[model samples]
Target chain A: MAAGTTSSTEVPAKGAGFPPFKTETFPSQIFWLVITFAFLFVVLWRIAGPRIKGVLVTRRGQIDGDLAKAQSHRADAEGASAAYQSALAAARGRAQALAEENRQRIGGEIDRAKADADAAAQVEIAKAEARIAASRGEARAHVAKAAQDAAIAIVARLTGDTVAADEAASAVRAVTGG
Target chain B: MAMNPMEQFTIKPIVPLHIGGYDVSFTNQSLLMVVVAVAASLFLTLAMSKRSLVPSRAQSMAEMSYEFVANMIQSSTGEDGLKFFPFVFTLFVFVLFSNFFGMIPGSFTVTSQIAVTFALASLVILTVIVTGFARHGIGFLKLFVPKAPLALLFLLVPIEIISFLTRPISLSVRLFANMLAGHTMLAVFAGFVVLLGGAGGVLSVLSIAPMFLIVAIMLLELLVAFLQAYVFAILTCIYLNEALHLHDHH
Candidate 1:
């Protein structure tokens, strides 16, 4: 009994449930292999391949669309920037021109006013010079008349004789001197 | 000498079936792989058949799986990621179901076997290579040459090429190792309980502790199931990105 038990234990349970298959043989391995490969290729090709391809195509389209949109946006932004710069430059030029035109208009008004004032001052100076000359001439004449009247009164008193008013100046002088 | 439960790890030929000069013996392991695959297809079909707006429990689970895979693809690959959603989703479901099916009593783990895991990894790598060539043609060879300082290129290029080639191997090994190690541990621990219980030793009852621990580990393995699937799919996405962009992300 001990020997029986030892042999069973030592023999390492062989062929109890199922039989062993050989792998070294070429035909059997190739046969099973062909079966597995054919099944895999068919299943993968029919079921999985189409779905994968669809997904890839969709993704490629999306990326292309995004790139196109980005390019258009860049172009729009560049155009806007250019437009803004041009508008800004034009506005600056217009502002400078308006300011220059305003300055010239103001200067022209001031110059015209100054010229009118000078002309009026020259006219007043001319009137003042004519009045001064006339006043000087009248004063000289008054002094000469006064001196002749005093000489006539002295001659008339010295001569003690009747004399006409028109001839009194010369007659009085002769009378006063004699 | 006591007969351990794990003595069943040895390969045993059952049915003497030959196909085209090759021995295609039906083994316990292959039966389990079929069971896992069939169970997965049935569950998904039954769950998604209703396609209800307000989902039933099974339908919700199905929808959740779909949406989860969909979201992963979209986030990782971008909106263009939609193309690969179905492939990624199918991969996630198959791997997840295979992992979960292994947790059931008396089922074989297809992923635990190197050949199965390698086959899956090869498929992913093949897709990457094919897609790269399809998209970029011969220029795809540029993925190997690093555009760096001329001096650094000599050092970095060889290392990069090796790492790139290691991807499929590492991917296969990660899944295979995890499944193998987890299943082996559970089997060993289970053997402890069975062997000890038969002896009626005090430690026989104490096996309950490790038994409970094993159950917990199984649950953790289920979570690992989802995680491994996600990692595999995401790595595919990363590789696909390298192919699409040809910018060998070192």
Candidate 2:
């Protein structure tokens, strides 16, 4: 009956001034609230909560596993380095021992060679002395013979007598000896 | 033109429903809450579906929310208070998203509603009371009785009991008042911009200042939204912790 009186531009009358404080809407709002809050709580508690928690737990486990693996690897590396160090030290000690042994052997060989050379030089000196003595004796005999001949020639020329060569030689030899 | 800022708080049914003598229509406020709740839940679900060790950006967000609430609960309630993790988590995310949704240009802020906030606050109080009784038996009454001297009980007990009774009101009013005041202030300032610019003079240019202020306030509101959610969740955790600890020691 009032349809003809309603106007389009007229702003419709609102129920209450402040809707939040409106007693009428309270039940519906709270009703929807209970439903929505319950839905959200269920979703979080049953699905979202556990899933996120699983991811977290998995990530943490992964971290802990990786850390343990890294620690083991580090320990292995330290052990390897220790072994390498010990091996190097042993090799250095062996090299020092080898050098000492070689030096001692070479020194002993040098001392033996020096002694042999000294003995050969002494033999050579003795042979040379013997030969010099022999040569000197021959030279003296020759000089004695020559001196007797000269003395005989001189006596003969002065006294016309060729005395016995043996006697002259004997006299020359005795006079030189004296 | 004196725009009514209070009108923005009015609830109108987008889809009207009448059951018996009751009005349970899917109103704008309910719609706001439903959409926010569903959207938030869906976002978390989709983000965490992968559960990647190396989280995607969305997954990081989901994980951040999880850890943020989880850690807060742990600190306040320790391991035991985690029993209420679902409740606290749901409350925090819902209020947080609702606050943020309200920040949108013309969206309704569900948390600003006294009825809604009071309902949530009442739920927390109910949980705390039930939990306290269940955990501590009849000794839970001691909560109203402070550990001070008997003469001091004359002053302390009444204070403790009154404060306890006021918890729900305080909690609800805090969130409701904050959102209500913040939104109203923004609307008032926006109304200023409209009025000043409508005046069409140097005042139009002056509108820029309020516009900029509104932007800054918006950024502040974003922080406030998160902060309020954090406070609500942490407080819930602390209350639950009190129920679990029951006077801290024998």
Candidate 3:
């Protein structure tokens, strides 16, 4: 095998020289290299390059748009929350005011009712006093009449004779007066 | 059989064809070049055919490669340098595919040839020179003139010019030498394994050493393949940056 390889290489080296350094192969190698390289360059430049660039550009645009949309949605949510808070505060204030007004109105009604009751009680007390004074005066007159009758009767019985009615009456009056 | 490692580097004519006076025969090297170009194109195009907003696995790979090259250019050459994105992308993908495909057994490594690497390096330097001259005119020559004392300018300027002129040579030699050396080393070690295994006796058992070494080197070669491609693209970016910016730090 060694001898075979040596003979093969020797035969080639004699005629064509070392393969990599051989001037004969330079033109062919360069020729094909130029052709293939140019073909690749054209493919990349015209077709593949633009495709990749487009995808990248599209992705960037999509990401930016999504971010902007997210920002707007967040702002909307914040606005809604703020409005809800303000509305709740207004409702709370109105409820408190209504409660306070009701309290003051009810208190005023209680005070007016108490004053009316007190005035009505005072009038009833005055009427009861006047009635008691009139009743007492009438009772005193009845007692006096009873006492006069008893005196007249007793005098009549003791004298046993018909005396003047006027005289008896006058005597009773005088005693009572004295 | 004692295989000659240099045999793998030979360019045999696959199709004999002549154009006028030149022997433009399609060889194994040419076939691999076409394959690389076609494979690269297909990988990129087919992967992105869906154009999915949420990329699939293949799509992600395609996009990743695209972004990788794009970012490299952007960082090295700045935003304005993006105009040469297609050119840079082509160079990267082509060289990357060539190196990777060559790793497969029985495949030719197009980038292993000095002629091929030299052509690519020449292309980069040519683009730089044309762009520099078109953009800055005579001011582009000021790149060779460093900010130094008048006494040192005479010395420094010549050195800078020579270095500038050797850019293509260095760039080409770096890639070509790396590929050639790596492939040759792998072949030599593989040859050892075969030769030892055929010897019989304890030598057959001892073949495991070279076999293990070959695996290690293969893994290293894979890394080198990727690194060399990245290095080539980044260097192109650096050269383009120099042309575009001249003396500006950015």
Each candidate's number of clashing pairs is 8, 0, 0
Q: How many angstroms is residue B161 displaced in model 1 relative to the true structure, after the best TM-score fit?
A: 1.1
Give per-residue CA lDDT, model 3, range A1-178, as digits (tens): 2344552224333344566888888889999999999999999999899998888788889899999999999999999999999999999999999999999999999999999999999999999999999999788667666666676688779986654556655676677782
How accurate locally is residue A158 in candidate 2, as Cα lDDT from 0 to 100?
A: 95
Report iRMS (Å) of candidate 2.
5.8
Candidate 2 recovers a fraction of native contacts equal to 0.69
- Tens digits of lDDT, candidate 1, B86-170: 5566566656766777778676665666666677788778877887898899988788887889899898889888988998999
Clashing pairs in 3: none
lDDT of 3 by residue, B1-250 (tens): 6567777788889999899888889999999999999999999999999999999999889989999999999999999999999999999999999999999989999999999999999999999999999999999999999988999999999999999999999999999889999998998889888889999999999999999999999999999999999999999999999999997954
Query: Residue B134: error of model 1 in Å?
Result: 0.8
Q: Pick the candidate with the highest DockQ.
A: 3
Native A-B contact fraction in model 1? 0.10
Which parts of model 3 are misplaced by more than 4 Å? A1-3, A6-18, A117-178, B201-206
TM-score of chain A of each: 0.61, 0.78, 0.65
TM-score of chain B of 1: 0.88
**Interface RMSD in angstroms for candidate 1:** 6.9
- In model 2, which runs have C-alpha deviations exceeding 4 angstroms? A1-13, A148-166, B19-21
lDDT score for residue B77 of model 1: 65
